[model samples]
Target: MGRIVGIDLGTSTSEIACIVDGTPKLLPNSQGKLVTPSVVHIGEDGGVLVGEAAAEYLFTRPDCTFMEVKRLTGGGEVLKAHGKEYRPEEIQALLLGYLVRCAEESLKEKIERAVITVPAYFTDLQRRATAKAGELAGLAVERILNEPTAAALDYGLANLKECKNVLVYDLGGGTLDVTVLELFEGVIDVKASCGNNHLGGKDFDEIIMGRLAEPSDSADPSADERALMRLKKAAEDCKIALSTREEYQVSLPFLLTGAEGKPLSVEKTVRREDFEDWVAEKVNSTREPMMSALADAALTPGDLQVVLLVGGSTRIPCVKKLVEETLGTVPRSLVDPDLTVARGAAIQAGLIEGSINNEDLVLTDVCPYTLGTAPLQHGIFGRRVFFDPIIPRNTTIPAEKSKIYHPAVDYQTEVTIDVYQGESSDPANNERLGELNLSGIPPAKVGKESVEVSFSYDMNGILQVKASVLSTGRQVSAEISTTGIKAKAPLDLSRWEEAEGARKFRPLIRKAEKLMAAGGDPGGDVELLVRRVKEALLLKNTKEAGDLRDQLLGMLEALEQLLQLQDDRTLGIDRP
Candidate 1:
């Protein structure tokens, strides 16, 4: 058996880490960098390119290349670029496949049994899509942890060893997640959570791109489009550069293209202050949400002992300054802010594999929002439809919750069901997660009929829904449809049996074999990690060293079978 690897499948950058002995450690890429850009390029023939190579092609191959993919996680239209359309899930799997391969190569072992992280605000469809991406990549995704919760775990294991209340402020590349965690004895309890799925670093990039766009002129639309893209890329570079230096220079060498399709190169130097000012609006949006999450958790800024920041966007001086100004205390820099979530996820994997003693650690998470369904309640204007919440916000996961509904009219023989996911009372305002219809009931006075609606959400955030007529055992069913993260719309199995996309993604069967050959596939940077794990365990602290030894052996063995085929159906692994 081998160790279980933890992955932060982030929107902008992805990272993997593992626990050695009793401590968490980051697994670096071949470049010796902890974070790998979650970007990928699909060649004309479908051979995939990932990481730095893929990032390099972003500007050069704008058409065929896909980035900022986490934007389209659920069922939505595929994005078009470089004259090609891409389903978000497909592109995501490609990225996951690359990371899985990198993990195997780095560790020189068979890698299996991974704990992957997702945004707290991801809808059911979105979560399912993420899971499918892991399946396609060939890793047995043991659990899908929330990103903010993972950050809290990192804080719990490393800094907040003593019982204390903490808040995790995670503003990443594509979403914002705020979680309140309390450390009691050894448990890391997430009291409350909230976030904006459409906000974060990519929004900052778009803001700069908007500001850099050349003023529109009716006569030359093509010129403006070319100039804008060139300037936008240049502005983004300057933004990233300024974070590390007092000031940075930007060169938009091809601000505008000539009649022969040649580009005009322009240059500019940007100061940190100026760039921050340009992005102030994007940065300010975090304030309201931070305050809202505080209100929801019934805490004020003064109540927090430690405010942990997680994500690459937090590296910006302005972003850090704003948080400090609001909380009146600088956040602790104990964890490599960028790798904290991945480290936390790996720590969780260790616990799940029974390698680490969880007697001291319990992670209690909340449902970020409400789950409901749309049904006609009245016939004011020919059957008025509205949302009825089943499970309210902030409920714990791996939880079973149910709500009962009764007939609205006399002699009703049929009932319409429209399942929804969101906090709004209006069905239109919330996303239609799924729906079904129930029939074949004894025609009785509508007020005499009854139905039981139940929903069970597993720890991984996958959902199971059930609706049964009490009088008649009559029911219908539907599961959150997930063909891949790249699916633009749910492919109806009956109508779309061909499944061109489904057959295209190769099952990770063979890759699992190579992964198993490696003793412990710890993901990328495994070679250095093996050395680090050994050094950490040899520490003079007897108790800590013993804990690490047990954890390491457990992870090593589990990692071995994670690549092998398991016969258990309930665990959700596929047969060879």
Candidate 2:
């Protein structure tokens, strides 16, 4: 039997790890890097290249090279390369196969079994697609772990004696997940999880890309794949650079040819303040999920003992500040934010392989979405289809819940159980997993025919539904399969609103914006302060915003004094 390894198959990068000497350690790739770029390129000779080797071709061979395919998993989209069609999972499989080969080489042993991690908000179809990718890579998947839960495992193993309410804020390359868990005596119990799968660092990069192409004289820089790829690469670099430095110079020479046949370039100095402003709305979008997760866990900001930052995006200064202000606590990155999830998955692999004692560590996770069946009901207007939930969202896994329902029509003999997953009251707004048709019900009045429906959700997040006809004892069950189902659009968060107090800062915001536009401060301090105040307002951090408002007012007064002093000196009124 080969060893079991843990893999974090991410949108921007992928990593492989395993347990060594009772400790989880990350395995390096062929390039001697801990993380592998989630990129693949197919050569004209039908050869496949992955990781760093494939990344080099992203600009030159844009048609055959694929990146960020993790975002397309479980969707009904097909990618084309050199006249060959490839599914998202197939591309992911190529990356997975490369990771496994790297692991085998690093460990000097075969690896045939594995544990994989996915975002907590990933739908059933996405999870199934992830597992399918693992299978396609020729490994027996031991478990499909949630990214936040896996991060908690890594934290818990090191501090087995400490008991604390921990929140894991995971903002990766392509997804955001907020999970609240309790750590007690080596047991990690996840209370609730919420997130936006479409929001992440990639979105921030796109914001930068727009800014980079703003000065181009070309009609459309995006019309050329090579030029677009160049812009994307540069945008990503600029985003990473501004994380540490206050400003970064983005200079891409000859990005594209203009309509006049002259080459146009992108020359811009991106300030961190401007970058934060550009991404403020998207970054602020994470606040709702954090509050939702904390509320679902029945926890207050004061109750949380620790906030663990996970994923690469958490490194952003604005993101870190958001976590601190929203949770009323300083966030901690005990482990490398980029590598913690993989380490946790490695620990889980250790547990499943009998290397780490099961009694020493135990993990329990929750279903991130609600599971239910659509049933007919009488409404004010007429008969309507309503979502009747059996297992609510955030319910601990390996759970079973049953609800008894009656047929809607008189003398009904059959019923179709349409299962859906979401928080909406209407089934049409939710995702349809699978359905079961239960017939052979004895003839009876609508209210008398009772059909018992039960839902079973396992630790792996797979759902199984069973429906039984009470009178005839006829039953039908199925393990919900998401195969052939198109993934629904991203969740709608347009209705989210900031706290009521955010309104009170409008005057201050307007004043700050005016001052920023005047631009007399040489250090750009006024601009930075203005951006922070706006972010605080967007995040609904009244206290932080108020403090920043005071600071801005003071700065404005000082600037006014300096300007008056300069005028007096120029007019010879204060000549000494």
> Among these predicted structures, which one has the highest TM-score?
2
- Candidate 2, pairs of clashing residues: none
Worst window of 10 by summed lDDT in candidate 1:
484-493
lDDT of 1: 0.71
Q: Candidate 1, which segments miss by more than 4 Å at Cα?
A: 79-86, 218-230, 244-247, 258-265, 330-333, 379-383, 482-576
Output the lDDT of residue 214, model 2. Answer: 67
Q: How well does each candidate superpose onto the true structure, as a TM-score? A: 0.78, 0.82
Per-residue error (Å), model 1, residue 204:
1.3
Candidate 2 per-residue lDDT over residues 1-576, each given as its tens digit: 768999999999999999999989999999899999999999999899999999999999999999999999988899999899999999999999999999889889888999999999998878888999999999899999999998999999998998899999999999999999999999999999999989998899899998888644445887889998999999999999988999999999998888888888889999999999999999999999999999999998889998899989888999999889898965475877989899999999999998898898998899999999999999899999999999999999989999999988876766888999999999999999878777655455568678999999887788888888664344677777756322222212222135456566667656665755666565556655665565455555677778887988898888877767778989989755
Error of 1 at 28 (Å): 2.9
- Assess candidate 2 and give its TM-score to the true structure: 0.82
Task: Please provide, for model 1 over 21-66, each residue's C-alpha lDDT reduced to its tens digit, 9 standing for 90 to 100.
Answer: 8877777776777788988887877677888888777766766677
Candidate maximizing lDDT: 2
